[model samples]
Target chain A: MILYLMCFALFLVGVYGLLTKRDLIKLILSIAVMGYAVNLFLILFAYKKDAGIPILLEGVVQGSMVDPLPQALVLTSIVIELGTTALLVALAIRLVQKYKTFDITKIRRLFG
Target chain B: MPVETWLYFTLGFMILGSIIALEIKDILSSIVAIGVVGLGVSVAFLFLQAPDLAIVQFLFEIFAMIILVRAFVKKDYHAETPARVNGFLVAISMLVIIAIFVSSISVFKLLPPFGQPLFETAQHYVDHGVRETGAVNLVTAIILDYRAYDTLGEVTVLFTAILGTITILRIRNGKNAGRKGA
Candidate 1:
């Protein structure tokens, strides 16, 4: 309840930053923040009360294991995030070379 | 408290941290904040019992941070002026919309309990997945065999993105080359 609200708020804050911020780096950070918020929401979706670790070992009780699917998805998403960040940074570098300043307002060579 | 409660708390913290990251003004600070957000999300994945996801996320964060840092080092750091907008109204409207959407969804009752037919089906695949698909990882079996076309599309998208990025970043040959050719 409260947790979900918090997540939503966080996501909104990131969105606001991404939309309003002129700095390319801040925009990237906002996007990353949004990604993290979504990931957190997904993980929260899988949680179960009193669920034990998913691993099955000797003498371990059955029927109390947590869901493993979300974890796997999160791992993949993390990798994807890494790739995105790398690409974004590469683009930012190129943009910087073309334009001397990091101020995005001054680097508006591609305005529609 | 139950593990679920703790997980929820962690999620809350992650959300808070992400919000802060987004709002920060400094570029380097924002990058670091984003990295922290990624770490928090990875931790959340661990709590969800997705060890594989956690591992992948950890690796991704490292690569992303490195790339961002490199870019910052290669470029000049400057503060950007804030864009003007009706922030209060937008925030209010967005919050209202989100509240309505979330409340309508009823996520609590959307999915059935664990070990349902879906799990049984997934488990069946896990049991004999390797025999049919020759893949050790059950997730891989589902991804590669069951969703082969989807995977192909994804690969195509990746290739396209790479090509686009390269094209966008291509450097033009200077007047020296032109003079030499003349």
Candidate 2:
């Protein structure tokens, strides 16, 4: 319960950074931080106390194994995060190339 | 150590790392701090009993760090954006946090407790996974067999992202060549 709130606070930190940061790279990094915080929160949903791994070892007692579904979901999400981050950084690079700076305030062609 | 204790500690580490990453003016410090946050979250995943996720996270963190480093090589070390502290931004942020807090409290009341019953789909796969899919790991069977379509979609997403990146970057290269030729 408390852990979930902590994750939420972490997410808000990312959000605050996103809203406040004027640098393109910093914005990109903030988005990534938000993604990580969400992933951690999702992992909490499937956690079980005294749980073992979700593998099917031969003759191994399958007692209270942690839920594997969220793990699977998170696996795909992590890869997706990589893709999005790359795309954002690529866009940021192009922005810098065009504007000669990383500051969003200076890259005002799109704003007005 | 108690599980709660570990969870709290991991969360604290992650919060601290992220704050540092976002708050710092130095670009290099921001990158390193974000990596620390990533590793801290990976550790939290481990404590949450998801070794596969931890591994994937650790690997992906490496990938992100490598790309970021490459990107940073040509870019300046310091963020030149001046910090702004407008009341509107602060108000919106406070409102969002409050909304999240309220909604989360209500949602927690409606949902089942920490341990949900075994999902029948997962249970079926777990019990007969080895015999049916010939994969000793149930997670492998679940991903490769039971949810093969989902995996295919994930692969498609990766391909699309890669294609987009190549197209975008290739344009810049083409423009550079045109300049050189001119």
Candidate 3:
């Protein structure tokens, strides 16, 4: 489907940035982008046509709900992404402090 | 507009924002652009019938933006790293990899087409999850009850990350702290 391919494109965009970008902050953002793409893909998988949210409510048919398992898994993943972003940012700050530059290429200690 | 239309719009917005974020020279602009992508994803979550995820995503976007902004404040605003590898070569290689990936996936037909989910396990949860777990929201039930151990592990990972961040920031540089006679 178009959605799946678009999601894959989003993921590839992240990969391209990760591979090509040199700034530490850009690398962090690329990682976050990849996380978003993956989370969206999982949510897309859980969707059902015309299904309500997966909360049991009065007068609402239980069967007419989207899958909840992936939602729960994605919740965990989102939190994990947050923690990862925080840690990466913290590491970036320390690297900046030690090396005096955001460019990874400039951070090398032993120059030929 | 229909929900699908709006969803597509948001997805396109996210893709555009990500591209802008990466291509822009200004670090602050890049951060704000990625924030837009995150907010658009939160909106997509709502359209996809996941309010809980929407809320979490909204909160996450706010927090992530705050952290990134705080970290970047008063720091170098513009950084342009010249490409060490040829841009054209990277592009061609990526295209080849993507083509291979797409062809393999299409030949295999790995995923069920968009709307049709394989819900064999989910059916049991939807039927008896509320009665068994006493949680109206099946997602909450699964997270808090059925997968409590997993939740515990998630919390532990978060805690460790925060603790590491604090430890990394708190320690003084070895050079700054004069060493005692060895």
Candidate 4:
């Protein structure tokens, strides 16, 4: 219960950073933080007390094991996050080249 | 110590690292701080009995750190002015966030209690996963066999992201191309 709240708090911190930060790099960092929170949440859900990893071993009884579903989901999500982060970094690099600044506030020509 | 204690500690470190990452004045230091947080999450994954996730997370964190450091090196700006955030807006947003978090706690109560997951199809996966997929590791079985479509979608997403990155970065700016070597 408390753990879940803590995860949510971490997520809110990311959201706060996303809302308040002006730097493009910081924005990307916040997105990464949010992704971490979500991945942690799913892993927490799959956990079981005293359970072994989700693998079937020979000569060992299948007594108890953590859920494999969420683990699979998180696996896919982690790779997807990697791809997005690369894409975002590429975009940020282009932005820096064009504007000569990492600060988002200075790149307001689109608002005009 | 119980696993919960270790989990609490890891989560605390992650939260603290996240705060430091966001509040740090130096962008490079902030990137390092975020990397620590990512590693902490990977540790938490190991503690939760998900070695597969822990391994993937470890690799992902390394690659992510490399990319972030490269971005920092390529950055044009040397002077980082402290973020000038509006105090009033921060306060309002904090209050709203607190309210939403409190409300969500009630929703979380509907979820299964810690360490006691309510399994439906997951039970079937555990019982028949090895026989159906011939994979000893149920997670691998799920990813590569039962839920193969998800893997396909993930691969497609990676392809698209790579394509987009290549396309965005390959553009030769007419004016800046002469000044800056791209």
Best by TM-score: 4
lDDT of 3 by residue, A32-54 (tens): 99999999989987788888999
lDDT of 3 by residue, B1-182 (tens): 76667777888889899989988988888999999999989999999999999999999999999999888756665555554756786787588758865785674367887778876688888888978999999999999999999999999999999998888877667686663311
Interface RMSD for each of the candidates: 4.2, 1.9, 1.6, 1.0
What is the clash tally of candidate 2? 0
What docking class should model 3 receive?
Answer: medium
Give the best candidate by DockQ: 4
Q: State the TM-score, rounded to 2 decimals, of chain A in model 3.
A: 0.93
What's model 3's lDDT at B65?
Answer: 95
Q: Per model, how much of the real contact set is kept?
A: 0.36, 0.64, 0.72, 0.85
The sequence of per-residue lDDT tens digits that candidate 1 reaches over residues B40-158 is 76776666665666777777788778777766844556445556656786677667757865774476345554223134334455445557877655555555686567556656655
Q: Write the per-residue lDDT of candidate 4 for residues B1-182, one digit (tens) a residue.
A: 88999999999999999999998888788888999999999999999999999999999999999998876754453535666767988898889888999999998888888998776579889989888889999999999999999999999999999899888888878765666443
| lDDT agreement with native, every candidate | 0.62, 0.79, 0.86, 0.89
Clashing pairs for model 3 are: none
**How many residue pairs in model 4 have overlapping backbones?**
0
Per-residue C-alpha lDDT of model 2 across residues B1-182, encoded as one tens digit per residue: 86779889988988898888887887887888999889988888888877888899999998999889788754565554565656787788778877877787766656455545334456666667778989866667777888889989998998888888766666654446765210
Worst 10-residue stretch by lDDT in candidate 1 chain A?
A67-76
DockQ per candidate, 2 decimals: 0.36, 0.64, 0.69, 0.83
Q: Which stretches of candidate 3 lie over 4 Å from their true place?
A: A59-63, A110-112, B81-85, B100-110, B178-182
Cα error of candidate 4 at position B155, Å = 0.1
